[model samples]
Target chain A: MKPQSLLVPALVAAIALLVMTDPAMAYLDPGSGSYFFQLLLGAVLGCSFALKIYWRNLVSFGRRLFSKSRANRPSEQQDGPE
Target chain B: MTGINEVKGSFRDPAGRMFRRDGVLYRGIAPQGLDDYSMLMSSGLYEELCAAGKLIPHEEAASPQAPTDELRFIRPREIPFISYPYEWCFEQMRAAALLTLDVQQAALARGMCLKDASAYNVQFVGPRCVFIDTLSFARRQANVPWAAYGQFCRHFLAPLALMSMRDARLAALLRTHLDGVPLDLAAKLLPKRSRLKMGLLSHLHMHAYFVKKFSSGGAAASSKNTRTLPRNALEALVQSLRSAVLSLKSDESSGEWTDYYDNTSYDAAAMDQKIRIVADYLSSKAPAVVWDIGANTGRFSQVACEAGAYTVAFDIDHQAVQRNYLDALRSGRGNLLPLVCDATNPSPPLGWALAERDSLTARGPADAVLALALVHHLAIANNIPLESICDFFGDICRSALIIEFVPKDDPQVVRMLSMRADIFDSYTPERFESVFSRRFAIERSQRVGDGPRSIYLMTKR
Candidate 1:
């Protein structure tokens, strides 16, 4: 939503546009470097999408972790009979 | 069309071969495909995907055709109608692309991978696209890139880009290039500005460059270095591709018939009356599958679907089909599928030996066929003879036919004739029925209100 957030994508796409401008007649993309790049891109994108898909879980996990830590601190500060 | 008929498209994967006996579908699993399949079955991925309707379910047959060399024989649920990618509109193609990814992602979670992601492997379960090839799965290798990445780009990505970046009608290119629109051609045809998009830049344009630049004499030195891509990376790739495809949604073009129902000559009451008649005919003799040809915006097709029939709504107009598909998505109706098709030149069988995909006619013998308000375009505009039209219908519909004959004086038909001299003299309703009588016995006929269109319910002779 921020202008700054839009800047990175616009920049990356502009560069990609520059790189992809070549008029290459050879479209046989069977395991080419660009294909690898796409795989890498996919992996990154997939992870982010996955993160978004499970954002609720991620938030709950964070809350549970924080609550457990707070509970542990009180127990640690208050020594038991031992 | 029955008994041990081998499905031509099923042979490519050594994992299995598909065949039909009577009306049921049987899959013969190869030795190599057994372990992965068993793992998938045991891991509960197959059952889960099927439960979600993302995958087609199959069961092991009691009898195995070749028990020695094969793992087991299985029977898959037969698809109601088999439609090709070329026949799909942008929304359909995009949904299919996403479905393939969803299946792959689910497969990855269970330590399995799709050996191939060919669009041919995906088919319409109704409005939704699903993976049908039971044998496309394999155990995932550590740090291995998606082997079907390039295939995905071709079959799904390229055609989509062409449609999005250039024109929607370019989807027909899938007919000539069965393997998919050549990536190089897609790159060339794509507008210069498309390179600005990261997905298109990396996947298509740059891919074409590398393919041409490196694939020199099949012994390109750079081939060896294209090694093991981590699973994380593959997942990211799928995600990126999904967004890329999703963004291309706005590029669809609207056709004249996109808003057809809005401008139709029929008043609301007349339209309602015609719908009642069609629905009555469908309910009396309930059909499992219904094909509504020239279903502009699927208004009446919805009626067939409401009658609990699996309906395929075909229209030559892309925008109308897109709108129809959008409506299905919005309403969440799985019984209706909207496809872009020209009835005059129906989809012909293409691919390996012209057998991989079935022609529109081959996929049918539908339990019922609806030809509402479609005759005028065929007879007048397309110059198809009335008898030939009847013959085409007879070839496709096995049981029932609900067709409407628009009179010559109807505004739509008159508009069609206004362009040229009225050469279709035998296109009268009497002549139409007499010609159709050769193949069908008319069961009922009614003049749809005061309109010039007459609807007929006929049974095959």
Candidate 2:
């Protein structure tokens, strides 16, 4: 497998290890279901958040590329009759 | 700590206990809470929250002697009246839920997190909801999910969603389930279409499934199995929960009394006169705290509020209470609180030893009570005797009672009697005055405009 593909799994494993090792002191019982659900939701939301940021970046990059190409074109050619 | 009487409901948290010494409420923080207390004070979160009115303000009180078990004593400003979650209208409950979330977010920003999200921790001072439990905060630990996540879902999200989507009456479930409505029960009770919403599905439906799956035990026994939630992930989770809460809207369409003002027998002139009468009585009494029983949309309660009295407008109808609450919020009336309460069967004492939450009557005898256009419903519709109604008013009113006695000939009472037998021969104006006079001195009585109804100003004996 490619190193880039291994990165995600490695990060997940590291996070899981950290989660297991961290000691939590809570007076109220954080139910097993609630704890696990939060973890699952957190991961999903984190990924989506990252994806949203990247998506916006990608869109802006595409816009910049398209605008650069348009700018390269002759002004007279872009506007036929103004 | 020797003379102080610990608050019964405050025993759950080991870090501190709320106690009263010489009628002043103080929190005695244990040695276990020293670190967190210092962090809270040093981090400036306490000041920020108090300034924003999100938290109840407190001051360091002089301790006679620093006991070994006690770290510090803080005297918090007393809440005039304590009300429970079940008594709160839809908007009030929603406001409380949002306030809890906002406080949680603020705490997170200061490297702290709420250790518990019990609805009991949130108290309403008029229209604004404030967090009262100072010991609920703990220093945030990295790679751990919120300890109060399940509680938030149960205490706030589940009930709020149920009230918004299913039925407004479902909010009363909070009375029975002191911890909060069970997620599984909430999931089942919610409409099937609610599962279609991603927020509800993930937070409630799926969360319930996970809880049930792990209920048999051993699933959460080993810390090695716990999955990490990074700080950003935790923030994302809180944001998602906030979105979920925000997405659920309060249903203002339900309840019988939402449109009652428009359909009442009283004309505009009569209502105006009635308002003036109530205001006159309130001003004469000069009550600091007033409870407007059956305050539909809080029209007369507003008069009491305008007369410089902190008023609690209560109604059995959820929509009416919600409408009243919204009006209070819009008008920025900090002295007016609208609550949902059935006069017949009000909120009873609940929780551990049945002493944790005070019964409706236990919190009162308010300085005054405004029972306007409500006696007929209790006496005629509910078949409650005039004597009993008078006795009840005596029990709930400390000094003054400004109650309207709608006679049998009144249009509203006549309409009410249309649906039931007019067996209440004793439900007469003379009988009302006679019975109430047993417990109170009738100071003044005036007829409402040209109507047969009369508003009485009585002082409790």
Q: Candidate 1 lDDT, tens digit per residue, B1-461?
A: 32467888777677778877675788877787789789889988998899999888887895544334566889888777788999898888988899998899999888888878788888986788888878777887655557677788889999999988888899999999887787789999999999999888888887777667655534433333344455555666777778788878646556879888888889988988999999999998899999999999899999999999999999999888988998998899989999999999999887778888889999888899999989888988888888899899999999999999999989888887886898888889899999999999999988887878989999999
**Segments of candidate 1 deviating more than 4 angstroms:** A1-82, B1-3, B66-68, B217-222
lDDT of 2 by residue, B1-461 (tens): 56667688988889988877777788888988889989999999999999999999889987734454777989888887898889887778878888998898899899998999998888988888899988888888766678899999999899999999988899899999999999999999999999888889999999999899877555655542355676666777888888898898888575798889898888999888888889889999899999999998899999999999999999999988888888888889999989999999999888888889889998998999999989988987888888888889999999999988899898877787787677988877888888998999999999978889899999999
DockQ agreement of candidate 1 with the native complex: 0.12
TM-score each candidate: 0.84, 0.94
TM-score of the A chain in model 2? 0.64
Write the residue-wise lDDT of candidate 1 on A26-77 in tens digits.
1123455444455445445544544554565567678999999998987887
The candidate maximizing lDDT is 2
Error of 1 at A70 (Å): 20
Off by over 4 Å in 2: A1-19, A74-82, B1-3, B64-68, B223-225
Output DockQ, candidate 2. 0.43
